[model samples]
Target: MTDLISENLQNKTGLVIDGAMATELEKRGVDTNNDLWSATALIENPEAITAVHKSYFQAGADIAITNTYQANISEFMKMGMTKKEGQDLIIKAVKLANKARVDYFRLLHKEDRDVRAAHPLIAGSVGPYGAYLADGSEYRGDYQLSEKEYFDFHRSRMQLLDKAGVDLFAFETQPNFDETKALAHMLKLDFPDQHAWMSFSIKDPETLCDGTPLQQAIKYFNIFDQISAIGVNCTTLENIEPAIKNIRAVTKKPIVVYPNNGDIYNPETKTWKANRQAETFTDLTPKWLDAGAQLIGGAVEQHPKTYNK
Candidate 1:
């Protein structure tokens, strides 16, 4: 396998990842507040999932991170869905993104008559175990699970997404070393042909949510060849530059950074505080790129309109 995504990311600079899928879904009137989060729309409103993907393509996204963030089998089964149904939904998430890419390409070719309009890639999203807990441990990263437990939780989803044929894996919003290490090892040992970009949610510029230094974590993660890019996501705007600098100093891999919309996430309240306008986020893009982020965009509070800016 050629690993087309790694090739594309290596060849392209300033690659624009799509903004928040859940935020866009909420904007379109989908309630994303339950344990299932955005993944609920997979069963209740799948068309809405495809619609968000289309909006991001229209907004100039170079990659569509699939809406499988909260679509794990165990959780779906708890919601009265069968194991097969959950797997089918995960596969559907990838298919919807691929359909949007095909549809967008048709429009682009008809309008511009150019093949150079950055062919979009679909990245299958694998959110951390905390996202399943829905207790905000994704930002805290202090889970008490063993590596085997972590693997058992994530492997089914990763396997299903792989079978669905996404262009790459996005092991994103991880906040601890154990989960990251376990997932990285799983990918290396089980799916060596595929590549993934692992991003973390940090407590600050230097520390991950688990109190591990970003550089120290990167040093361990960078040793894995299956991890194509290493960086951060769902972090604050102010911490991005310093965080990227720390990662950049240690690894030669492509760096990806997608911070929140210049707002503070109150884990206790389960809401964003003091959300700023898109312009505040747009202003920070240049600095993040200047700090050496190859793939940059926004998470949660960001919309495609913001991505367009």
Candidate 2:
């Protein structure tokens, strides 16, 4: 974890990343009914997106993930946007995170003595190929595409995200070993300077959704220099501990974990079946840290109530 932190995010100990950008946006009254989800806020209400980022920063998040989880050109074209317009929106997602970080620091650090607050890092979101499908495939992860095909799907958007100057990348909620390999290889070959973390959406503690063994996947991906950390996200809370312990047994690289609010997601319905096992992120943080997650936070439920102010 210490090795993965850039010079900007000075605290290497236990950095808190912000939670669901889309959920916070919906809380702020952004309409998120379409296939585009929160990315629509980037076009319809960008300030609300930035406000979500600011709220997380104010709430003590050390890193802010840009609102590009579902931002891609293929979907934009279906919505009647040109390729250029889609690319611009992707770039705008990163800009909003930067703007929010600036505003957060300026508003909170008006005096030099308040410089104790470290500038939060921006992580460009790279949701899996299933996210573009919008059929709950991100959690399923069986894209059935070849390696080259998966690489092709990710290349353009990654280049634009890098060009937009994000401090790092967050490959969140990935479900298959093949696509994970493809994306990791893409970063190694094409975007050598960029550092990214890959978090999978697992089916159980030991297995990925595609039925690959979790230990085998981490052992292979953890060696890549560009692939900074490996772990799980968008999964149930009960599944996180066993997954983290299994990951730690295989590799010493930083483990990053951001599970969902313990709800079951139905891809066909595109809705979450809430679970009673849900615990506040604060209550779960120590357990996750003790279990071996270096970076810890919430997703889908890291709402306005989680904020301090």
Candidate 3:
């Protein structure tokens, strides 16, 4: 009984680079004079999605995430996709990732192709529930079914990931802890054989949203099984290393760091430019490896160069 995902997770730490936003950008073709939303462009041409994954694989990434994060059914509803239609889109997205995995394996380990037979694992990404029934300010408001809404959302998508044969299932950019925890449990229940990873978004102050200390989050998350790793994502590059250090101080579990490129603001373009210097990001890679970081990679706006550098 060989567990491919857990085997990869047990090995020495490796990079888990980001690709969705870049895939969207490349597919959308950003114009300097005009800002664009990544969704519309990706829906039109998914090859942009495939190319991004291949680049990460070539850059030494050990895992690649499919472009199915925000492609969830609920999120798709916002973009006018029915539940069936969204599921179909995700199935197609995973297939594209599988194709990239085949190509990446060929490029990176051409010699080993005959031996390994498979490329790096493809992690199916489940994103935020995206249905904030209550206003942001109403954090305590009675948003009915808040827990069920999120859990059901993840469970629905997890089933699809299972059918797609994703090597791992990852829940990322979670804003709330209880909801994230629920999703984790659901994944474990559904796929006791595969691996699961959770990544929380950092508050502006670099803590969980409930003012819960970072150490508390680490302790709270320690109860689950099959959770190969945990870390911070979708935040500034500068904050990730320190945040991960704090996380490591509490748990012996593997830590993942996939911070967004950088904070961005657009005066005239009304865009958020979350790109960072690949060289500097690369410099921190060694330190992160030394800091006991078991996994590291980029989030939004991260290019293949970041990992390759």
TM-score of each: 0.92, 0.90, 0.79
Candidate number with greatest lDDT: 1
| CA lDDT for candidate 3 | 0.63
> lDDT for each of the candidates?
0.82, 0.80, 0.63
Off by over 4 Å in 3: 1-6, 9-13, 23-42, 78-80, 107-119, 131-145, 204-206, 265-270, 274-279, 299-309
Residue pairs of candidate 1 with colliding backbone atoms: none
Model 3, 175-240: lDDT tens digits are: 666677677677667777777677776664257654556677777778876777788676666777
lDDT by residue for model 1 (1-309), tens: 565556665544557788888777877888888888889789888899898998877766778999988789999999998889888999999999998888877767554423222456788999999889988999999887898998899999999999999878999999988899999989987888888999998999899899988899999976787787889999877888899899999998889888887767766555656755434656777677778888887743334333222
**Order of models, best lDDT first:** 1, 2, 3
- Cα RMSDs, all models: 2.7, 3.2, 4.8
Candidate 2 or 1, higher TM-score? 1
lDDT of 2 by residue, 1-309 (tens): 233453432444566778877667877888776788889998899989888888887767777888998899899989999999999999999999999988877776455313322446788999988888888788777778999999888888898898998978899888988999999888889887889988998999999888899999999986797777789988888888889999999988788888877766666655567677677666666677788787776753444223221
